[model samples]
Target chain A: MTEKGSAFLDLMGGEVFRDGSQGVKIRLTIEPHHTNPRGVMHGGVVASLLDEAAALAIKELLGLRPQDSGPHLLVEMNVSFLAAARPGDTLEAEASVLRMGRRVAFAEAQVHRGKTLIAKGRFTFVMQHD
Target chain B: MTENLSQLGIKGEAARSPFSGFIGNVLEERRPGYSRLSLKIEARHLDSSGRLHPGVLATMMDSALGAALRDVRRKDEEGIPGGTVAMDMMVLQVVREGEELVAEGRLLRRHGALAFGEAEVKKRGDGTLVACAYFVFAIGRGSPR
Candidate 1:
């Protein structure tokens, strides 16, 4: 971790539910600050959670601890927004790794607002080795 | 200051708001079907790994293209509000401090009320392409806010 990083995740606090084979689930609350001028949950918030989940999944797959895993940059991501979500809503994101290669890893994730699928995401990351 | 402009939540002509302003996104140039936005890379824009976060790039790319959706049609069709309903992005590279990313967008096509746009994020100085993205916006006449 760098000196000026991790503030966004820290602020938008969430819980990680480790799964046996399906990967992991990250859950967080949609707050006012997470909304746009339209007063709904921002898409960027969803993307952030999706990206975070993918990174963590890759880290776990590589057997690297969170603090020791180091930084992994995103190579690509495709997200499709299926529904809109608002503040006071609890959001959950789940990721399932498709392929974890030596250098690149791919994971697919989805965001749900209490059973209503809000968005689906596919992310690719460049694995970091320090 | 301007009445019609206030509908966009802009005080005068500045569309900068709490969320976007906080993100430090600036609309450098805008016209019908096109827009240019830039953000100065900072520590806050970085992720836990310290490199610039993909979420920030995704947000910036979406915002840049979405800003031009209003101009996709004729000027007479004003008062239409919209937001990114979907987006697809590819990160070509990454950057850190001392670098600024510029997102430029242009309309790709239109599907009924939704407008599709393509954008590219590049370093402001050396013009190194960081990421490219496409956005889909849901727009229509909404109650005046």
Candidate 2:
């Protein structure tokens, strides 16, 4: 993993679910730091997970190359949360590439707990040029 | 001074409530998506051209997506265990600082292991469409590795 990758993994404060050539999976314990006042995981946390997963997915598709300090830029995304996440709940996010192109990469991700679908999204990242 | 912002419950409460943040504030149901969030657009939240920062709009849209999915599950009383990851997104509008905007995200489709959704952000009061996005989420267990 890249140094930035390792640092991001540390910042997520979650467990790993899947680590493969395609992408990485991460799990988080719903805590006050990850939730809003209503007892659910904060949306920003969700977005952060999405951003990380999307970037990682692209990196994996790119074959773990050391090109630049910046990995990828999130060009755009759409996401939906299906249920409320509470403190102590296990939240996992997994990602993979749908399409990897020269200038952009398309990816998909899911977050769930034991078959209970919480949220899912798709993102596009523009490859940073040197 | 910043602590008081949390008390008002207008500053992204769903992401900070007790039940959800404090006691599962009920205000979220009414807002639905980005419109519900008390979005604070400031000079810092804008781009160099004096428009709402794409990051700020992105953050708001991401929040709306999470809220919309949460809202759907709230209707069924089913607990959402996993968090969402953005698979892809597109921004179609530009906003400026001091300009009020509202966001709306809705669930479009759900399969056995995946879910689909879209979001829209617009200028509040004037109802000017600003941006829209689409997302895919994996619904299961464990953490990101």
Candidate 3:
């Protein structure tokens, strides 16, 4: 899941990986621009990373391809920040598919800096086909 | 002479933001328990689906809710300052590039070092709600835990 066309990922930065060969995961380095006023990883960045991971996971579970399955949109997402990450820190996030039905898919995710959990959340993804 | 949230600090922060791309985000105003922010949708903000990226909306809620919570912390007489520690959000509608977004957040309550808050975002033109969120934060004057 390169998501090569997403400029947001290009600017904010993210790397997508497959989870268990069935789920999706994202890795991001806490960059200078990713920090907030206090210099910790911005909550916005955390949220975005989670969303991206969830989207990737959903696509994997649903077998939705960019050229075939249309598109996947976030129906809902929630995140809880457990710890703070700083610039130069490499954070890895992974999403789990809790369930996948007809229209919606549920997922849970966590971002960790090595052993430290930075954040965790769940998401609802809805697949739209054209 | 201001010892709090100096103009220079805000200006300096606006520079390094990751969302400072095409559909750039701007911090418009901040007040105790409340804040207003906006983003101008740009071509680059779109995803592979040719729609506004969900992460962008999440980022907006993240920044807006955090800013509002920051102001709320400033008002705390205890003199504690921290940052947004947790957030839960929902995307209620779809969005696209070229559509400006306006977001606002207000504090729901504060207990000790923790603060609870909620925020909403809508299209600037028709005020159609696109997304909303609730946030929790921990603040301290020196380093927010």
- For this target, which candidate reaches the highest TM-score against the unseen true structure? 3
DockQ comparison, 1 vs 3, better candidate: 3
Worst 10 residues of 3 chain A by lDDT: A62-71
lDDT of 1 at A57: 68
| Candidate 2 local lDDT, residue A15 | 47
Each model's iRMS: 2.6, 7.5, 3.4
* Count of steric clashes across candidates, in order: 0, 72, 5
lDDT tens readout by residue for model 1, B54-94: 88888777666766665565454454555678788988886
lDDT tens string, model 3, B1-145?
Answer: 1123324333433663443222367767677777667777776676656677777887777676666665454444343435678777888888887888988878888776777888899999899999998888776443343
Tens digit of per-residue lDDT, candidate 2, span B9-106: 64345444422222122223333322244454555443223444344455565555655655434333354455454534466565655667666667
Q: Model 2, chain B: what is the TM-score?
A: 0.65
lDDT, candidate 3, at B136 = 81
Candidates in descending TM-score order: 3, 1, 2
Q: Can you give the DockQ of every candidate in the order shown? A: 0.49, 0.17, 0.54
What is the C-alpha lDDT profile of model 2 across A1-130, one tens digit per residue? 3233333234446444454544466667777655642445766556656555665566656666312233455667666766667777887777888887778778887778768887777787676567
Worst 10-residue lDDT window, candidate 3 chain B: B1-10
